[model samples]
Target: MSTILFHEIVFGPIHSRRLGVSLGMNLLPYDGKLCSFDCIYCECGFNKDFRTKTKLPDRENVRAALEDKLLSLRREGITPDVITFAGNGEPTMHPEFKGIIDDTIELRNRYFPDAKISVLTNGMHLNKPEVFEALQKIENPIVKLDSALDKTVRLLDRPNAPGYSVAKQVERYKRFKGDFILQTMFVRGRFEGKEIDNTTEEEISAWLELVRALNPREVMIYTIDRETPAKELEKVPVGDLQKIAARVEGLGIQTNVAG
Candidate 1:
């Protein structure tokens, strides 16, 4: 029952454990959450609890607000390391996501040319040509792949699409051609009385196979850092995360651990 929501279209220059000084861009509604996957560990809380009247912010408003914030920061002699697309929910769900990305890049060039643009997505929309193309344009396109097993993925991510499968998602990620960063959240817990732990030997073995296949620029291994909707879930320790990273690094893929 712990729920947290970002209340503005443009919020935060918060220090990200992985991405560093990031200014967030929320394409979803400011008052509610809208996402393709209802993840068990989502800090924003369950989608059912966040129903609201507010609509997704349009491209124009997002551009204006972001520019204003960047200009103000510039005046104060501050520049974020990254302009991140993350907030209440899935950012690519926006109708004009590609165009908004275009606008963001333009603004970044005009203001903070050295800053990187990153999108923290679930990778469900990569099937769409536009979404895929827009993602390719960004500096850091971090996509999620919680587990390689279909059953474990369902238990962990709870993607809204019943037809969502790990094989299909892995294939979609393949389309990126090693240009994206793969972000996996490792957690152990029970949902509805069934025990769930994606950090097990079987799960990690299957997941490492997919990681090797993808050959991403980098692999980000992390655990829950805040209150989750599913209260039974537990964070993986830094030592364990380092072990996981070592295994991943053995595959010749660089890994970053956020524990």
Candidate 2:
């Protein structure tokens, strides 16, 4: 049941396995996790286990805090490669997400214009006009799509929305029009007794079809790298990840593997 939670509005210039020198922004409450999906491999743990009593950080507070952090980094002669929106939960869930992203862009231009702005979202909120517009403005909008099958999505992601489905998710991602990055987590495990693995032949074949249809700017295939709330989960090997990357590369799309 090990989990990691960010306690500050803007924390870290931590080295990311994929995005280098990332300065993270947490729009969710500092006290707990808030997400649309309760992923089995989430490092933030189960939502029920980390409920928050505090409110989400307001737009002004987030702007001020991020500006201060950017100023401090400038003073230290450190330039982040990316200012990432990956906090306690789904960043797009924040009511003021659009405004915060606008502020982040402004601050990044003023401090480190070379740095990219990225938001790691579950892609559930894309239907929201504000979320969609905000994501479109960012340099890296990494959307998660764990499986091409509705059953696997239900078993793995445990999305809170009753109407959530693989078809709808694909449609939501299609709105990006090849502008977004598709991120998938490959894992093998048993949750509550059912076997779960997205690396199977059937899984990959179906997933590949969707990949071809989407034709994203890049495909990011990764496995669990931290202690997950569901102890039964196991990481997919780096070699396997590279093999999968090869299949994606065959489509003439850029791919990155972080196992």
Candidate 3:
């Protein structure tokens, strides 16, 4: 066992390859995990057998902790680029997600006036009015769309719900218009004996079409950075990743390849 490593409701001014030096707010339990997607490559480990009770800190506590951390870092003359909503699992799963984001925004403005607030979500709750409103307020609303194909997405993400469809995700994404950032993990791996790979030509083509339709502000292409739970997964080479990025850029959408 990896000891299920979350220290508190607020953890990390950790290095984020995409978001820069960021502060993380984990709305999920410090010990338990709750997410709609049991992603095979989740750094937090697969969504466990725990009940769906979300151990989210209250909105005021999130603000106070984040403000305190920001002020402390300011006293030390340290600057952070982004204040992010992320953690052991899908952040939108928190019942008071909208309130948390609102509190985080107010605190960010009070402390690190220049720092951007970001939310990394699985797009599970995008259709909800409150979730959408909160997301719209954040500076970086990065949503995950690992694959456009229904079956491929379910396999890679291991969605917990009965009717988790990629089309529904795409529909939900439509509400964001051009405000959202898109992230996709390109890899080949097997889960529960299902052959899964999103890096195939057909897969990429389908995904690109969706990207074009979404017209996202940014498209992030990243393969695994650390050891994933699955062993047989193959990393998409940087060159290949760049090749995909170029295609996205050609569509006039900003694209970043994780180096």
Query: What are the lDDT figures for the candidates, one per model?
Result: 0.92, 0.95, 0.83
Off by more than 4 A, model 1 = none
lDDT of 3 by residue, 103-197 (tens): 88787788788999888889988878999999998889999999989888777888888988988889999888888899999987676677778
Model 3 regions more than 4 Å off = 1-4, 49-54
TM-score per candidate, chains pooled:
0.98, 0.99, 0.94
Q: Write the per-residue lDDT of candidate 1 for residues 103-192, one digit (tens) a residue.
A: 999999999999999999999888889999999999999999999998888888889997899899999999889989999999988888
Residue-level lDDT of model 2, residues 1-259, one tens digit each, is: 6789999999999999999999999999898999999998899999999998999999999999999999999999999999999999999999999998999999888889999999999999999999999999999999998999989999999999999998998999999999999999999989999999999989999999999999999999999999999989999999999999999999999999998
Question: How many backbone collisions does model 1 have?
Answer: 0
> Which residue pairs collide, candidate 3?
none
Give Cα distance to truth, residue 22, candidate 3, Å. 0.9
Question: What is the alpha-carbon lDDT of model 2 when measured against the actual structure?
Answer: 0.95
- Cα RMSD of all models vs. native, in order, equals 0.8, 0.6, 1.7
Which of the predicted structures, 1 or 3, would earn the higher TM-score when compared with the native?
1
| Weakest 10 consecutive residues of candidate 2 by summed lDDT | 102-111
Candidate 2 runs further than 4 Å off: none
Best by lDDT: 2
